[model samples]
Target chain A: MCKNALTEEKFRELDSYVDTLPEKHGMLISVLHRAQGIFGYLPKEVQLHVARSLNLTAAKVYGVVSFYSYFTEEPRGDHIINVCTGTACFVRGAEGILKELENHLGIKSGQTTPDGRFTIDALRCVGACGLAPVIMVDGKVYGRVKTGEVTGIVKEYAEV
Target chain B: MSAYRMHLLVCGGTGCRASESKLLAENLQALVMTAGMGREVQVVITGCFGFCEKGPIVKVLPDNVFYVEVKPSDAEEIVSEHVLKGRPVDRLLYVEPEQKGKVSSHGEMPFYKKQLRIALRNCGFINPEDIEEYISVDGYQALGKVLTEMTPEALVTLMKKSGLRGRGGGGFPTGLKWEAAARNRADVKYIICNADEGDPGAFMDRSILEGDPHSVLESMAIAGYATGARFGYIYIRAEYPLAVHRLEIAIAQAQQMGLLGERIFGTGFSFDIAIKFGAGAFVCGEETALIHSIEGERGEPTNKPPFPAESGLWGKPTCVNNVETFANVPPIILKGAEWFASIGSEKSKGTKVFALAGKINNVGLVEVPMGIRLREIIFDIGGGIRDGKKFKSVQTGGPSGGCIPASALDTPMDYENLTCIGSMMGSGGMIVLDEDDCMVNVAKFYLEFTCDESCGKCTPCRVGNKRLHEALTRITEGKGTMADLDNLKELGAIIKDTALCGLGQTSPNPVLSTMKYFWDEYLAHVVDKKCPAGVCTALLSYYILPGKCIGCTACKRVCPASCISGEVKKVHEIDQARCIKCGACLKACKFGAISKK
Candidate 1:
């Protein structure tokens, strides 16, 4: 209830944004993007609110959410680390880099740290093949990342 | 119009931007101002130069001096030496890998020697955010020419004669697709630019959208005119923040300039474009799946024949084309179809943009003629394999494509030839592999991707691909029988025959192609339980060579599993049962005592 009260303003902001859209026929994906942007992750309450606002069933919204990998139901950490597992990176020793990060963070890919400080994800490709063996810490790309340098790179965010 | 004598074009592509080219641009601007050459010099941030191997690239006009690997600190030297004294910096010039000489001009570099730049002509040349820059390069002239001078039928005929096929993996003729859409009767229709770019190692589409977005938009409007569609949508990936930003600016600029909005050129034909963001679904790269995603569905594909050309996007006729496909349209409309068809091989006309990556010396986007040999692309244009290593194989296409071995290196690259070699040009992702890469493991990697990305709509894609992936996993884990190889072939053919969508049908390519070319690698894994490349950890064992051991404790000290047992000044031995195969000992061994087989 307290969480609800805290996020009431965010829901209102989302509602007003939905109202401003010219047509709502095929705006579910865009509206959900906006909702996720506001709420960090989509809980049942947010999905219900969106369903009610858009005159859609809750099952429909949940189905759409679960279908896309980008949408998450659970909350994430302060920083998200995405390791590039694309072919270009894979051939250039991306698996070793991923293993190093897992050892450093004490968490597997797609799992958040217990302290909620970092979450690591193995992304398919971010399309920066020029910089093979790439990783992104909160959307700031670091290219040609070596296995030994993984610990040092994570320390910058951990310390802050 | 301006009194600026020297123009500095800094690469602002995603690759260079990752290397902090933004800061480099700002630093160059500040230094130019400090040198009191603000009136004489101008610094402009342009899109990708495609020379991403040696970025951040800075090109100076008038002298045509190209600098590579430039840092922010180099800004002062550039403004002072190059801008003021008119002398080019020697240390920053790109040294040819073979010649070992400083190549100052971009034209002299071998990387740019055997290249064509129709789709990417304006990428490194102009600021993508400026409409004036695009207009100056004859960007929207195609749209004006189509709307005023030519009729819809003439445009369709011109496209048919051009012989341009889709650059998005499938070599479907673009002109024929437009003709089908034009034949359909509907009051409301749609034009979709497929910018999803779902290929794992491909970034050409993203580069075009980031570098010359107006070209795509103008072509989309032209497509709308040809197909009788007044509304358009660009289905793009949300992960591409920079491309999305540039597109928003390009659309707003075009609309403000009366080029995109209603009654463009004050003609009766009107067209408008809006962007729809994709939420990380690779299956959406398919036209039907892409349409469903735009309609806010689950991005799953349905059967075709009621193709989007007939019924699409709220039950309206729609024509969907890839970003590279649309980028090639304006040029075809401006230059006659025969002029465009004169280049490249028969059946597949014009050049193709390939994202050349992985194990290659030059890992960047390259646009070459259709009939160019794979040998030329890998050796001449790509500067050969990195570190002078022996060439093993190259994986063309993406997960849906196959690997071509060294024997097929001379095969001319085109839709027919690549398919004939058991590999399709899927979205033009050419990933070169060296001797260190394991063919069986590479096949397993792609199967894993397909199993994950499959929409799970049809059983062949959902369950059949899963079974194939399981067989691949077992082989890679050294727990396979020779019978598994036969099963993989049978199951792969079944999936290809019965799968509903393009993604599912082509999902078995990686396995089939690798089986066809690298059969010995698989036989070794199944019969001898040895991974020839030593990539599969389950098939590898580490040991210390008694001859090479200097009795050093380096390997023992760095062993994470504590499996290496030895004392100071004593030869070390690895406990086979306890060794985790992390390879830390091999890296830590200073005397080269540790080896894996």
Candidate 2:
């Protein structure tokens, strides 16, 4: 579903990288991680290329990718706002925060906004429950976030 | 080295860092430099202090005086008043909840009084990135002692003599697990650090790895020498980027220093470690599932007749241990078995670290000796319930654990006692609940997690948990009858009894525990069709208290549904039929007129 298949530049990089790893048994996961890193999200085209390079079935690669929540099958937005719905956050009004985000972004948790600016994802507890009602944009964390502050935070990111 | 008489150690843990401890660190350093006492005063940024409610904590050295809720603005006052004039910033000092006085030292504070840090010994004390800081605190001496002097059998005996159980939920004896792996003679055996902690509120493992990674690496090498294994894999969650980043630096530094990879301490034994990323599967926390994950499979658990110790990781013997478990190893070796054994209760040994959160004043990581009562943890260490609310229940062990009622407040927190009360001491995620929290909703929250994370290989966990979630959903949505409660009870018991893996077996804990302790709440949901805590949206009804309504049209303006219609300065009324019960109007009402009934 990508624009073409893989570009010549991307193909050469991937092919050489696969040669460096063991193709026998345990290198599929490593290759998949690298592939996902190279192409922001793992589309079917990339998965197929990985299968061919590693000499594994596309079904095998797809099975592993679909099993984990980290790998995505589609393209994501520039910024993914992960609001922690972990037990502590949930108790500390995380749902309200999520609802506010959904309204402001004009999309649900899984869907990327039409402009491809932001995507909302609810993650399980991130072990920072001490900062309950926690949200992370990209990798930076915003703690003790209140419902009132949601609009200002989103406005700041909207320009970016 | 500069002669620094006073050392101000600040909390650099994730929780404190989020609250601007970095700014506080920078500010303190700036103020100290400006005062021309830079050499005489050292401002060091360390890991968590476990008193997170009162963070950006700055603990002064030599006297052990702990300052809480330290701001960047307070740095100048602290330096000028305290460092220069020999007087503490009384406003920044932590106020004791019990006595309402100026408690100075860490020991006098209720939060740190009962805590004894062993696994977290180096955290909040030294810089985790520095190898020399770790070495100064007797870090790699355990690996050195084990490699040069003691035999494999002697070390296992010492581990067994000390009553150190695995801190990773199951309370499996660490010594016995190592001995089993050691018995099976395999040339390419592997040692695994189970850093894939999937519990929602838990972060002790992440904190240990982020704050003190070398301790785990040193202990892993010791494990390799003892078990006749040369390769080790740390199966860590990918979500913890900071911990992962720190671990990478630590491993490279250790390998460069000749602590890991090829003949550690110049002995004949050689060991190496590699990082294997876990891609968001909670079931991988199980050893069998973890092994499968490493092998690039679906991370599904199998029957344990071939237990990981006998056959694991490409069919070779493997030894699996949690991060906190390995962290305790070096100290155990340094201070002998008897010395470690004398710290805790009969069965559980060494101090246990808990990620204490929810409705508690001091929300942070705490480590206390085993057999300490919940009263000490909740009231003493946790500084009681937040906003002066009444304590309802405490959920231990995350999604796999059960809730202990307020009646069991004095219950000693150990593996056996928690199990006796229908909960297990799961990787130390102690979330305190207040009176405002609904027990039925709490049970639903955990069931939702288990249902989503069930490996789907087994029927009881995959389907049974889904059914249990549906039953709970019906109850929360005010669509359930009394008979559904029996259905939930029967289904939860069956899933607990017949599910395949440890994850499947414990999946129904939240439901079963709530059923046992909060049957009254469940009965109210079914019989009365009301949520006492006003949490369930389906059961909530908006009512404008006419007596309290001073009516500035505050609720009317923000109402998305436009249900609240009233004049400028009169009692406002909510149209019941048009109301969607989003609670936006309730939050907007400054006069406290809108209340959910």
Best candidate, DockQ-wise?
A: 1
Alpha carbon lDDT at B537, candidate 1: 94
- Candidate 2: which pairs clash? none
Which residue ranges in model 2 land beyond 4 Å of their true spot? Answer: A1-7, A22-24, B1-3, B27-41, B73-87, B550-578
Fraction of native contacts in model 1?
0.73
lDDT of 2 by residue, B56-115 (tens): 889988768788888888888888988888888888888887788989888877777788
Docking class of 2: medium
> lDDT (0-100) at residue B143 of candidate 1?
89
DockQ values of all predictions: 0.81, 0.71
lDDT tens digits by residue: candidate 1, B69-104: 999999989988989899999999999999899999
Give lDDT per model, in order: 0.92, 0.89
lDDT of 1 by residue, A5-75 (tens): 32778999999999999898888899999998888888899999999999999999999999998898878
- TM-score of predicted model 1? 0.98
Off by over 4 Å in 1: A1-6, B1-3, B560-563
Using lDDT as the measure, which candidate wins? 1
